[model samples]
Target: MALVTGGSVAGPGAVEAARWWMRMMRDPLATYGALGRRYGDTVRVPFGVGRALYVLSRPEHAEHVLVANQDNYVKAFTYRPLRAVIGEGLLTSEGDTWRRHRRVVGPVFAQRHVVGFAPQIVETAVAAVERWPDGVMLDAAGELRRLTLDVVGRALFGSELAGEAGRTGRSLETLQRGAVIGTFLPGATAKRGLYQRVPGLGGAIGQLDGLVQRVIRGSSGGELLNLLREGGEFSDAELRDEVLTLLLAGHETTAASLAWTFVLLSRYPAARERLEGEVDEVLGGRDPRADDVDRLPWTRAVLSEAMRIYPPAWTIERDAVDGDDIAGVRVPAGSTIAVPPYLLHRNTDIWPNPEGFQPERFMGEQQRHRYAYLPFGGGRRICVGAGFAMLEAILVLATVSRTHRLDLAPGVPVRGRAEITLRPAGPVPMRVSRR
Candidate 1:
């Protein structure tokens, strides 16, 4: 493969790249946007004497790295911290391990099978929403987190996790923040044992371990859990890892997307009104069912649009296993490439008024590239729970919209925190009122 040659490639020099890296560590989402604007789609920032981290924003680049020539890439080293925290679960494991885990877990999330969980999802959401006091200010983010945790726990693990949501949320906050810092640490430091000794991370990991243990000990013969146990494929440690991975990834991402949807609805009342009107027309004051998901087009579109704006899995990164030319830029082996959905979704060329919240973009037949709006990523490594998540979000949104309206608390500032996921920086305070 040819070296990154001539003016065709653009980026900062070693010194400048070092500075950019520092800034990225501080505020990655903003820094990535700034880099894209300053350097165009493909920007190569040198890491050391030979290695480079390429920030590729184009959909074609995403398609190439994540799909077409995916064989030449693996999850980037940036995922090491997360792997250390979650262990060799589906999210982090590679090669035969990943294939084996996927084989065991994939069937459960099939659209046909996933629909069976709809009743549990709807029931959980309705029960949670009923508990919300009318005309009171509450943290929408926290509430959604609890609701999602409970749904995943009951639907998948046969455990009730609503009570654990508060501590789990705090632990996740600490773990995600530390994971970013841990990325720059030495390789060996990614070990679970070493992390257990760190100040905040130690406690966070302990809390997660306790939660996973509770799930394992308290499981009530959930189908997925029974399948894993009866198969005899997973060892004790592997089971713990996979359980923790599912518990965190499955719940956190969905919660974040729902919270963002609520935030966007509050900010754009017109969109909220249309969404409410759609819910009222379709469900008629009844809790949403599996079939109701397809009937609520606007609700689904609103969730899709929210995810496009604040993709939970904000970045999809890979490390090259061999030299290759991506589009026209030459990439050497061992190069780190980030194809962030946050950037791709907001690419002005593909999306008209990219920053605006417009559910209509997702309502009808769309003509954008397949890789342009990857809220759940692409190719084989795409989120395994994608179908399940969409189902849960649509149902939960419809259920909530049927009986309640949550308005953002006046004068509160909401911001995004870019960690393992892109979620609200703090509590998303919103006032709830009966519809």
Candidate 2:
């Protein structure tokens, strides 16, 4: 019989080990790195008497786990906590609901649709840039987060959300930690209750719910809410789930990705110079339009390289459907399978000088393996907004690069906190000056 591991056991790979649980509670990136270094890529950490985890980082392993034989796995137990908070949203839902959500929401993120949203994106970036005072140090991460949240707000729901950015930002922080906490507890019901009891999270979910309801009610023009409301075969609960998913998923990640890109550019002057040249040539003197993105190759490449190094959607995990061997270890059914993009992107076998910042890695006809560089993930469940995110990030980066140069104040240590998505630990302090 295939083993189904879901409990505490202090054996060869005990997930209950203090170090393992500490890593789970605190720093997963370091923990994963230590595990990979110590036991190789395919280390299994036992959870209780039955459940265990398999952390794999190689390209072939990622391919086999996330794409090639993906049918053998389902979204891992880690996502379960996130689902509890969002509830059947596009990112967390599975089965027929996921298919239907994908079908209806997919078109809105098409290249044409995404490109058409560029002007709005530029307008939002410009507006945020306008508020920045020279010599004034601000949280660059927070600012970009606000800007992208506003863009997602206006583009998807045709509503303005800049005012709620601060409150919403804080709320999301609480909700993310709660997601990890819920993963240890049993069932979605436990998570839903925990979210209510948590202070910042409870307020945040309430506000997000309020905001979504307003958007759904107030969307007289946008395609997202309309498609969600009138789309056939979508239940009301599923619609809310998807709306919440898109609202959070659509913006938070792109915002964080841009934040990391700008931070990297500030630290790397040569890279910034190249980015500026590309943007200047493409845009000339006018604001960019949907027709203009294709010509901005270097700008796009810079964004690509940025995501490769610090992918906002940094980790992808799955659980085996049936007990099976991957790489070498025989993973029991119900075991969590982790193939972190953060770790995978840094795999030296696939990326030369993996930790170095080099936009040129994507410049020419470099033959890259299909699953080697999966910033947007792979397989049927790959991020539906991948196209939209790329377009948005590139356009925003170009427009901002054309107008302003932001640098983190010296000695300001920027740290990333892992959440439902990876984000700056707190504020990313930077000085914004006109380019």
Assess the local accuracy of residue 236 in candidate 1 as a C-alpha lDDT between 0 and 100.
96
Off by over 4 Å in 2: 1-12, 327-329
* Per-residue error (Å), model 2, residue 244: 0.8
Local accuracy by lDDT, each model: 0.92, 0.79
**Best candidate (score: lDDT):** 1
Q: Roughly what TM-score does model 1 have, to 2 decimal places? A: 0.98
Give the clash count for model 2.
Answer: 12
The parts of candidate 1 lying over 4 Å away from their true place are 1-7
Residue 101, model 2: lDDT of 78
Q: 1-435, model 1: which lDDT tens digit per residue? A: 123332467888777788889998998899999989988888888886688888888899999999999999999999999999899999999999899899999999999999999999999999999999999999999999999999999999999999999999999999999888889888886788888899988999999999999888988978788877888999999899999999999999999999999999999999999999999898887788999888889999999999999999999999999988887778889999899999999898998898899999998899999999999888999899999999999999999998999999889999999988999999999999999
Residue pairs in candidate 1 whose N, alpha carbon or C atoms collide under 3 angstroms: none
